[model samples]
Target: MDFSHWLLLFCTLLAFYNLGIIWFGQIVVYPLFAKVGAEEYITYHTFYSSQIPLPVILPGFAHFLLPIALIFYRPEPVSLGLALANAACGLLSLVVTVALEIPRHNRLEKGGKQEDVIRELIRYNWPRTFSIMGSAFLTLMMLMQAFSPTI
Candidate 1:
């Protein structure tokens, strides 16, 4: 209802949104990178890279910032520790994305879908994927703790 409440809802929604997208990439999209034939791989990957930013970057950047906001504006029943944990998880995911995943993607983009690069993308993605999963879990816990009926 207030700022913190609104932030919690937004953060929770974003957490699950990120979780879904990352999981889909981990389970489906990244694996299929290997299947895109060498001939079409460049074209397909170029299109994929072009289209992905909208879905991936916007919510991801929002998710990154909202947790930091949560540290300052956590809703009722959400402790400072929980807020810090949420922020940490978001940071971990971002670090993994920037440090580990992006370079692999860059390699694939430049080299035109080398199997090693694709494999690294999938393998290096685990930390970010798991961090998102952790963020989702923490946000879910916060939501329940904040909104559960007083008994």
Candidate 2:
């Protein structure tokens, strides 16, 4: 019914959506990169990187920003501690994506058939994935805490 409530709901939904994407990307998508033949891998990677679905891209960006927003806005159900933890996870995810994964992806785009990069991508993705999943859990907990009848 208010700005804080909306912020909490948006953050919760985005984090949950991101967690799903992370799990699917980790388990299904990233592993399959190795299967693509060397000749086609670069083309596929280029297309994949270029053509990220809007639904994925927008919310993905929001997931990165929403926690920071939550930290400043602090809804009734959302404690400062929870917001800080969520922000930490969001920041970690952003760092991992920009610093680690993006470079590795860039390398793969140029260095075709780099199995090492692919391996590294998969290996390094777990932290980002876990952080997203953790954010989702934290958001859900905040919601429960918000909605639960007061003692």
Candidate 3:
């Protein structure tokens, strides 16, 4: 398939993969840690704080690449629109990750107050969640356009 098509498919898979991170963090990982005593929670928090940068930086770089690729490919209107929308959502997620989440993670890493860290984490995570869902929706729309007889 064309580059636009390939980028769309790549984004769809990436968004779905991110959804797994969201689900696992929200449902399994956080809750388990949250249930532990405060000391344990703090320790867990500190560990994760150190680890967070790797995930964020890698995905942020990938987010940059995807949009550039979509723009370069220059698909037809319907496909292009869908790809652009998906790219926009990915950009939004990247912004939220860099602007909001990374700072919080950095603070936590530095030995900032736990309450503040947790609060920021909770606040910032929703946008990432929504962006992933938006990417999925846009991908579905693109697929329909791609396979539709009229298109």
Candidate 4:
């Protein structure tokens, strides 16, 4: 329909897609990498260092922008609340990424003493994972509001 509508749909789709990435990364990918021993661990770290930032940066930026679009578009109050909640989740994701994840990733890439890096990665990753889940929830709520009867 309009920009806000399109933005909501896009945000919903992307958030869900991002959720899939986080889920797979946490459940399958990271665990697999973690089990591969030190050399493979280094390789996994390097690969993740090079590739993960792409997914993190763009979708992160989009996640931030979409909520602002919804706010600007001034949707219904229910829709606005849903959008704000979604945006807040994105903001939390950004905070966790900046405050925790990226720093750990940087340390992993630097090839230094990683005595606590894995532990920290495991710790910090959970909040980011939960934030994605929260975003998915909010996005679904927004979609419901977008489609549901205005009562």
Candidate 1 lDDT tens digits, 75-136: 76888888889899999988888898888887777779699888889998998888889999
Cα error, residue 129 of model 4, in Å, equals 1.2
Count clashing residue pairs per candidate: 0, 0, 0, 0
Per-candidate RMSD, Å: 1.3, 1.3, 3.2, 2.5
Clashes of 2: 0
lDDT of 4 by residue, 11-66 (tens): 88888888888887777765554465665566767776678657756876677566
lDDT of 3: 0.66
Residue pairs in collision within model 3: none
Candidate 4, residue 28: lDDT: 78
Model 1 residue runs over 4 Å out of place are none
- In model 2, state the lDDT of residue 38: 96
Off by over 4 Å in 2: none
lDDT per residue (tens digit) for residues 21-103 in model 2: 88999999899999999999899999888877576667877898788988877667668898889899999999998899989
Q: lDDT of each model, Cα atoms only?
A: 0.87, 0.87, 0.66, 0.73
lDDT of 3 at 54: 64
Q: Least lDDT summed over 10 consecutive residues: which range in candidate 4?
A: 71-80
TM-score of each: 0.94, 0.94, 0.74, 0.83
Ranking by TM-score: 1, 2, 4, 3
